[model samples]
Target: MANIKIITDSTCDLSSAIVKELNIAIVPLYVVFKDVSYRDGVDITAAELYSKVNKLKELPKTSAPSPKDFHEVFKPYIDNGDDILYIGLSSRLSSTIQNAKIAANEFPEGRIKIIDSFNLSTGIGLLVLMAADFVKEGLTLKEIFARIQESLPKVKTSFVINTLEYLHKGGRCSAIQSFVGGMLKIKPIVQVVDGRMILGHKTRGKIEKSLRSLIELTMKDKDRIDLKRIIITHSEADEEAKLLKKGLEEALSPKSIIITSAGCVISSHCGPKTVGIIYLTK
Candidate 1:
């Protein structure tokens, strides 16, 4: 078996348990509130993050891990004689992958490979797990890199915002738009297309309707879904996420459905009750 290490950033939204079990090294991003900063998922928890936001009445700013941060995480594994595969947040969304590349350059060539996931939350997590699986199968680093690149475009990521408050606070939408959307109970669907967030459909009435809309949209690709795994990730919306999970179970019947809470970085933007579906297509 080849000696290898899998690494990802905290924006991936994977649980610590899974990270520990897989032995994946995670370099944390930063969540800044005024002059104070905390490492996403390391120095902060989702509940605490939400509480701080509510108390401050503003969304916190998120930052990518620095090149130095990546170096610290990479050094131990390299010293142990292990090659590394780092699946990171999208270059379009943040400079995290760029920083990882800078850190990789400090090491010998071919010892590390960096992949731009072009995704966030569980979308990136899905790719990280896929790379880990390839490693466990004893695939060579070269072969695993090719497989990951092929699978990159197959990742499907979309989510529904339960409230427009956070979006407005973060300047994503204007106050008037937030007011009108709130009055009508309109939930906006955000889709990850070409490595950027684009507004998709808007569902009215209740949050449940939007959640159902997500399931319906996903079912359109049922025939092509990889079916190996599906992830439903939420920011303080466990019950709503469970509803979506049940609906997905009856409709798609995928082999595995995992539920994870979004980390501080994702939660800071999406706000409470935001839920997203992430999966791969064959």
Candidate 2:
């Protein structure tokens, strides 16, 4: 049995294959549309959520799992005599991390450790993966925490939102901004900075130019790129994701790049046609 167990929520947006391969435990969040609610990843998948989001007249809403949810997921590992390390979405974006911390406090001392990733989607997933790797390498809990802390500032994420309607709906931006931006066909380039989402730049001309700008921002520090570890996540925008990947490869020529779909929770906030780039820097 492993001495330490790694846990994360569905917001990580990691694939089942990767989770299984890494032997990591994931707790699911909930997505609600009107009176209907479903557990993320368990009751509904990215594909299903995407289809629903596209067809529904109103945008879907999402909620973080409660303390009870984290308690249930953590009990088994604790009962098995294994210490648990739970990583979660950014506190700036969700209360999931706070709930996980509360749940951890309910347990006996030294039994659980909850980490706020200060990131979202594959950005958070990248940090979770790094923690999992450290645990798999037989590192102590303290060592694992230290490594994650060190990598926090080095994790660079940048994205381009195809439309600002969802951002407006979520009250992250004004409706007038969305209206004017949408009319102009402006693509907003955003990034995760200091644990909160911030607008980095706006590309007004064309999609290609916007994409190029995103790639350039991500590859700004060519000397510090961690090529072997990078992730690109998109919300029903495979073509743009692919084009961004190719552009980044040609520019920085990273060691590897893994592309995957962003989950419903993230998609709910960013809306469809959102493309993100995540990388670990030295």
Candidate RMSDs in Å, in order, are 1.0, 1.6
**Residue-wise C-alpha lDDT for candidate 2, range 91-120, written one tens digit per residue:** 988899989998899889877877788888
Best by TM-score: 1
Model 1 misplaced stretches (Cα beyond 4 Å):
none
TM-score of each model, in listed order: 0.98, 0.95
| Residue 169 in candidate 2, Cα distance off native in Å | 1.7
Local accuracy of candidate 1 as per-residue lDDT tens digits, 1-282: 449899999999988899999999999999999979899988999899989987988788889999999999999899989999999888998999999999999999999999998888889999999999998899988889899999899999999998889888888889998999999998999888877777789999888989899998899899999889999999999999999999999998899999999999888788899999999998
TM-score for candidate 1: 0.98
Worst 10 residues of 1 by lDDT: 191-200
The lDDT values for all models are 0.91, 0.85
